[model samples]
Target chain A: MSELIKNFTRELPDWKPRVRPVNLDEATEAQLDALKVTPSNTKVSDYVLTLAHDVESLKIRSPLFNAIMYDKGGLKRSERELGAIGASVLNRCIYCNAVHMNRHAQLEKDTSVTDSILADGENAKLSSRDQAIFNFSLKLSSCPPKVGKEDLIGLEEAGLNIEEILDLILSTALFGWANRLMHILGDPVKLENNDS
Target chain B: MDALDTTTLRAAGLKGSLSAAAALQQRANILHLTQKAEAAVLRPKDFGAYNHELRHALAGRICNLNGDQITADQYSGNAGTYADLIDPGNDGGNYDLEQLVNFIDKVATRPSDVTEEDIKTLQKAGVQDPDIVRLSELNSFMAYQIRLIAGLRLFKEYES
Candidate 1:
């Protein structure tokens, strides 16, 4: 009954990921290993399991996702989620936008910040620092070919250190990968509203 | 130690450590594997072949069409022209290949447009179900690399 689950399940899809998602029970060793080490350390996400169809690739992909989204060296978790929200928004991937927005709210223990981003993106009402990072992510996702120096300067001016900036760049880039994969591999489905 | 020159790294907006970073290097290697995967797809498992370059060319052309200049500029030059690449004569540039590439583009730019029919087309074209899985995963990988490279290049100027 949580809002995140409700919203996620409510979203319908015209396509199912792949012709048929990988069956978790029947998956091989590498696929199961990939699932075991994910940050959640549980096979909770149907989206990821769907990706298990290509088990070998998932072995590398799962860890990479964990490394970027979790602590490797820099950026707070909430801020990284901000970068995810940025890319998902630009890609117009509502599923990703919703999930990351919910994660941000959970981590920060503040719903308003997530609300602003889900509502307005880079234009969301936020501190200069938050807005700059969001802008960088949006630009990175939508038109990476055109990302410029001023955008980095803006991040620096907003008080982000080298590591934080690099972290955002990495996270934003990861989401560009993650969001597209999620959109392609599977759709979110809620059990309660199965017929809705 | 420098596997890639500074400009190559910076132009892609990636750091020299791209080759050094385990996660990234793994992806770079994964990208290389697609060449092999497509190569296998193009030829019989172990027989004499008509085209050593045809499959490579088709995938190369897909990179350009999808605007993944990062992949194109690095691996294959932008040599596959639209007319020749699509092979106006070969079933709309080989219906099977065309269908796969078209699906790849839509996956990168607009996922909603992708339907089961896209995969079904490849199935009908003789692509094994397992290979189809690999093909779609590879498509997303290419999209990720392009976006990441573009983002890095965009941010490179300011990083210093």
Candidate 2:
């Protein structure tokens, strides 16, 4: 049975757009060019299609998004996912949260951390290291962004170098951009046959 | 454009920081892309309803609502005829954009509380689907940019 997923879960949910997605047949040349770079050129999801309404933003955003999350030598992919989850949770973006939570789990090869977060939310018990990363990101994602010197000091004490810290900020803020679009423009639902 | 001249770095006041120089250099590509994104949202070639000037005004408004006057003032220079909307208190009613301004502010500051009704309100106000997406991209980008500046400032404080 397909239903809107109200709470956070590791299970990925399909997204349903509230606005009309651009019809592929009628897409402008620019939109077609932008859509071609989506994760899979063979098939595009409703989310990408909906974003196609603003083709210019979609084109630039894709490369920027990938570089922040997948770039090497700063924060590990798993920790970046944690930053993404922090922003998603603050924004109540169910779809974004679920996607990052699953990725965090896969990268760490452990579900316990994600399980704790799903169960406890802001109070989720974590190692000192994870706690520092998550707390800093949570504050950074807040309205008006409450991050302070102590937060930076906390990260330093937790052993994140400047480069890693910068990457963390970028990933969390990236989701600040993402959750607004995903949560405001659509709903997250579990569908019986939808592949997206 | 010089890496130090990027909006994010300048707004965050990190252009001259000795400690941040190397880290900023390492992430130059992300900074460059971030600049490109600002252009894509604020000054698109095929802008449907929101033009360049109105887009700057709205961007300034979002920055003000988020408590970042520095970035807001930077946007104000290009805000032009719609500059009055940059003040969050104005409500955009002067230009028959009350609904649009309200929606932008809420999405910028309280996105989690936003519901489907919000989008419907914009639609009922005659906002087209593509324009709605455009408004969202603009608002969402502000959220990211504001936080990035805030985070970097904190980093600067630590380094100093």
Candidate 3:
């Protein structure tokens, strides 16, 4: 019998993260300060909060994520999400996959495109532009060297200027780190059963 | 890596201001920490390592990227090296940090595969919880940095 599921991202799980995150009360002053600057503010994501152990790194990492993913002006927010989702999928971080895939769906005008990419990026009916981004992202996430100049050239050919090219690179790079850590730090999910 | 402001670089060849590059330079703040973090892990007041080869199988494998040689070579000169630890396939030379490094590498590649047993192994190797977190962070950071440069290399190498 096929299992009935309501939502893939949100309804998926209330699973526990592998490592215990610092509770709001347990956070040091520096960690609290770092949390403040992040997009979620005191509502820190498990991934961001785990870095509270090394507040200095969190201070550095948080702003970098903001600039690359949220600061705006290079790639469209949706495009950045595309790169993020691609890397997350390849790295096998279900936590990141849930977060970024949902974001991709939200930012994109059509959820179907995001859904298609999620199913099978290689066969997804993405426009050449997104295809370029997806191909570059997949290559970078798996075997970085297999990627080369021609890859960026294809992006350029797809009409992305050099700046957009760089934006794609940065977003993809940030997620590389983000996915790697998130995988180790914990899984993401909202548990069912009234917080049981 | 002359540390050119991304704004200036964009102005030279690119037509428009790519805010992400400037944001990356001004806001990402990782470049600033890269040196210190690199030191804390690779050098650590111990031996020096320039490239990723590490003269140690564990660290080398942990650092393994697509273009193993090129990826290994990527960090040379910029990060500074006090130890001649670049010789490939050599045992960790003089450090006993291999166990933790290998464990962190395993976790980074396959987090779900990690179990309590892995943590126990690290503990048996005399690794503390704090050190484990640090090692895990370093592994993740390396993955991030390597991917960034690898992607950028395309920009630098591609004539277009």
Candidate 4:
């Protein structure tokens, strides 16, 4: 009976696989070349290469990438990832959410905590600073102009410096733009079949 | 950077081009209007009417607003009441002066104190002058969007 209920509640028509302009293999090459670096010597296929390239291209173009990778003057990598994940979740980008969630899990083994954050939001277990970041990201994602002075003050109170705060805002803004692009373009392809 | 170099950069990315910057700035302004529109949260019918009125008001073009004239090719697939006409992807109209000033004042000044009447006052006081109108609209929209985004952050802050 439980099985029947579960099956009954399942989506009537499983989502048909979305067709993409670039094939997995060709996209891999484009992604790798855009990043301007070769993939790891491990037996990486075109898909992996493409994924790396996409990240690399984003690194050069996106303020969000700089915030996550280089701008750790005040916030830790985990905190940055948390904010990013929050934004991705708010934007409803399953690809970005999944990618950042996996990264968070890689940093911390407790997947349930990350899952909870994904389920709820920045209100999930995190420092006040991280909470501030998550809140900021969500606002930026949903209604950008609604972000006001009080929000900046909150981050300042949370101990983020002016530069870090600026980075956070820019990162959030960049992701908002990127999320729109991703939403319009297509679903994010899985880098590996085994990836959760 | 040299003119040639600047041109090259502009070609490479949307952020790099003068036109692209203008587009982004315009988008930021529209986002602000959309926020205000959403806060008011008009019924679908009213929202659609208001969107139609606003587009005609801004563009000076009597568009059908019900997607009558819009073709599939022009569809930008943006999610908004005015998505058909004002979709960032659509190259319909440039920034208007009056709208630009309102957007700017909203950002630099406290919007809470400013009334719609004040906006009208500003508009009447030569806010829509051709000189600096285009640039002002672009700059104001970008600034306003940023500030609005900042304000939204505050809203979320209190929630936290």
Computed on alpha carbons, the lDDT of every model, listed in order, comes to 0.58, 0.92, 0.59, 0.40
**lDDT (tens digit, per residue) of candidate 4 on A1-196:** 0111111110111111111222434545534454444455334433223223223223233332443335435455655566566666665555555656776677766576476675565467666776788877776555323455577778879998654564455455544444433322233442333455
TM-score of 3: 0.73
Tens digits of per-residue lDDT for model 4, B88-152: 23333343334443443332222223233543454565543221222222222222233323433
**Candidate 3 chain B minimal-lDDT segment of 10 residues:** B7-16
Looking at model 2, residue A7 earns an lDDT score of: 95
lDDT of 3 by residue, A124-144 (tens): 678888888888887777743
lDDT of 2: 0.92
Q: Which candidate is the best by lDDT?
A: 2
What is each model's TM-score for chain A?
0.79, 0.95, 0.81, 0.61
What TM-score, computed on C-alpha atoms, does each candidate reach?
Answer: 0.70, 0.97, 0.73, 0.44
Please tell me which model should have the higher lDDT, number 2 or number 4.
2
Report the lDDT tens digits of candidate 1 across residue range B33-137. 323333333332321221324444444444565566555544444223333453223334443366655655566556545555666777787766555555555
Candidates ranked by DockQ, best first?
A: 2, 3, 1, 4
RMSD in Å for model 3: 6.5
Report i-RMS for every model.
5.1, 0.7, 3.5, 16.1
Each model's DockQ? 0.29, 0.89, 0.36, 0.06
Cα error of candidate 1 at position B128, Å: 5.8
Worst 10 residues of 2 chain B by lDDT: B1-10
Cα displacement (angstroms), candidate 3, residue A131, comes to 1.4
Instruction: Please write out the lDDT profile of model 1 over residues A1-196, one tens digit for every residue.
Output: 3222323311333333545665766766766775774555654455666666566566567555676678555688999998988887776666777778878888989888777765665577787888888888877766323467788778879998666776687778777667666665554433344573
Off by more than 4 A, model 2? A37-42, A194-196
Task: Give the winner by DockQ.
Answer: 2
Each candidate's number of clashing pairs is: 3, 0, 4, 16
Across all candidates, what is each one's fraction of true contacts kept? 0.36, 0.85, 0.45, 0.07
